[model samples]
Target: MVSSMEFLRVANWVMNQVLVKSCYGVARKIKSHSFDWGDLSYKPLQQPSSFPDIVKCDLEGRGSQTLACDFHKVLLRTRSFFPYFMLVAFEGGSIFRAFLLLCSCPILWILNYEMKLRLMIFISFCGLKVKEMENTSRAVLPKFYLENLNLEAYEVVASVGSRVFFTTMPRVMVEGFLKEYLNADAVIATELHTSGCYFTGFLSKSGLLVKHSALMDYFGDTKPDLGIGNTSLQDQLFISLCKEAYVVMNEGKVMPRNKYPKSLVFHDGRLAFLPTPSATLCMFMWLPIGLVMAIYRIFLGVFLCCKFTMALGAWCGLKLNFKDNNQKKSESDKGVLYVCTHRTLLDPIFLSSGLGRPLTAVTYSLSKVSEFIAPIRTIRLTRDRKEDGETMKRLLGEGDLVVFPEGTTCREPYLLRFSSLFAELADEIVPVAVNVHPSMFYGTTASGLKVLDPFFFFMNPSPKYDIEILEKVPRELTCAGGRSSHEVANHIQKQLGYALGFECTNLTRRDKYMMLAGNEGVVQENKGRRF
Candidate 1:
């Protein structure tokens, strides 16, 4: 039988071989212009400037070239066919290749087009497995399962402190389940997934908060009916709000025996409970890397510092706080959500490497070359909304999560609308503003050849990013409908824009693709055309 350590070593070796070779090989092929993927470029077929439609002329009643107006009317009346006439960057075989690539790498598909699909059914089976494995063990009370949960319940809110409602259904279904099972209208859950959208993933699960919240706030109203969160501070707010608003109060639950808070009390019809915080265990100090990997990391750090400092100026001319300055640093020691504006692929790379610590980055897709030679860890998102959300929560539970909330790199001196998903991940959010300055060559573009991105960036004499690690958005502000994630994202975007003196554009990732790549980044040319 293989020991655990040997198994880990073997697994690491396999990853190094498979990931490194494939990625590097692909990069080399791209460099040589031999193997290219998703190259969508086309010129529209030439036709008469105006096709004299006799039907349109008849509709006009006064036939002096009324066909144009009639043609537009036909387009307007046909809801499904309207989008087909929109500008597209590529057509025919090019579109098929793009679709094929996206399907194979679903995450990339999500990146180019934010269409999230359902996962395979095995996840429901696995959830059953989890239920069976520890059916008897009581779940630690979770947060955010119910909107407008009576804030008077504290102990029950410990595990999950907050939730973002992304859908309309299942409020009835979930409320029914909780009402039937616990005879309560509120459920304090660490996470929640409705049956239809459920997936067997943590980060993907986290996405449900964003998904449902987006749907609920479909009208773009910044103000949302967010309830008090399950954090210690918010629990106190619940007491004050209950007292001030004269909201009817109810007693907090006391699970069978010791499954709940240590104590419960009612002060003047105000509910309070002290759920014991989860305990942490620390063993004797131990090293993370083997002697060999440790030495390699040390040398790698030195080499990176030298190379970036000399050529890229990785950390030079930057205003940052490296100390444990954040009041929530202790909490962040496990994981803090770092929302940053993306400048280039190197943005995550240079920041993580310059910090001289292991900071995992979230991306839409992984390049085997980038992974194998990566200075820091990187993960590709599956784009399953709920799964993504739960995964980020898990990562935060493990360590800090760095996310480029802008969703895509903006080469122009402007910021795009940030994805609110990351903002919903944690209360301890750190906004990171990246200002990239290039000399001799620009390493950024919204529409450019894929092969040249890396090539041009490295060829630059020097590129610098003035990384500003801003103060954390206070937890109180986001609690109790104080600020929705979208609001928080907008605030952050404004803050970053002001700090960098960069213009902020209302254009989103989709808009960028539509304007540049022509069709929401993925379009089939001549999809249904007559020869």
Candidate 2:
């Protein structure tokens, strides 16, 4: 019985005599003792671009040096040594060659069969990996499968994190990825396939593997240089990913020089503003105070009359501390519309209650669904259907209107798309910004409730109210000809954002007022026309 060591010795001797001579004979030139495979790091092999470096280092190993004359020649020379050595061992009438041949044949057959099974299994797993890689890479992949012989095995160092490696690839695929996407590092993975089942790899700057999972986790990290320069397939993949992140990051870097806060609420409301405190005090103080007294008297009468619902409404108004502008202008000259930045269901109520007026409010269809039975007079705009421009024209052309251009409210202090019905009444926009202090009670309205601190109701409602009327933009600034309603709408929104003290990052003219103001509109201290 031949021991494993003896077999390796015989194999090695034959490999030297036949394979070495047929190939380069460099193995014989160098002393075998000088080669140290154990200490040789595999770093160079990991990079396909470094193949030339491998060839250059071939002189360090006698056996490797002999094997350097192209890979196939060594395989052929080794095959020739096999039969001759077997024949010499068994003599002239030897069946050793035949036995060796038969044994080799079965092993080959079994190996080939097993390899097919493994290949199928591996490919199934690989297909999933490929899909994941494509999703993660956001890059296209090859449409074809690799031949079994062309596939190479490789162990990737990407076990860390969610990263996994698909190291090996057909040379053509490697070449294609590099050429098409300008990836150069792919050549290393392709060269590994010569050994069968090689792993496709990407080297990160930290000398770590940027495999499929890694790419997914860090999609645009491994910046493989795909720019106008010489690079490999792997490099290209890395660079492309890095470039993607670069674009996204750089997008945020550009300063918005032309950005301005929008005036959507004011434009929609048609309420005039005078920033000067004296103007605002003159306009709002007297009328609002007088109205409150009159309302109190009316409330006493209604209570005496046993009109409970009207009393309830009055009570809610008082509780909300509603106050309207005190300035008394003639009805005809009250041409300005109250363009309140819409926030919540409370906004219309807030403005009406605060203003001490029977406001002609506009609401969307969704809001109208629940609000149809409400006593307030309002026009419901269909959210799903196109607006009837003429209907809007009639309303604004004939009467004072209160419009909330901002359609929704959010936590972020920014405006949304503004409504354009007020655009038709462009001659009468009075921008109004209302900010309400965040409520202490969990219950905001009878319809919606959010309880914060359980004991907040006990806290004083003093300093609870904050309503502000900002300086209004004139009709000349608002009304323009030959421009689409959208442009006018956008311009209005921008102005409102500026007036209301918000960054109009994504606001449009038709967005509701509540979105920018949250639940509360900022209260300008002076009642009427603030400059």
Best candidate, lDDT-wise?
A: 1
| Poorest 10 consecutive residues by lDDT, candidate 2 | 148-157
What's the TM for model 2? 0.33
* Model 1 residue 476 distance off true place after TM-score fit, in angstroms: 2.0
Candidate maximizing TM-score:
1
Over 422-498, each residue of candidate 2 has an lDDT whose tens digit, in order, gives 67654556666655443212112111211211112212111133345544544445555555666667776777677
Candidate 1 local lDDT, 1-531, one digit each (tens): 999646545654553344334443443444356322221111113233222222222221221110000011111121111011010101111223222322333342233211221221121121222321111011111111221123233222232233222221112113332433233323322243434433232323543223323322342433322222221222223222221111112222223322323211100000011100100000000011112222333333345543333222222212222322245454445677777888776666656654555677887634454455656667877768789888888888888778987777765457888878877778788777786664323444333333334434443322345676777877765533378877888888998888677777777767755543334533232232110
How does model 1 score by TM-score?
0.39
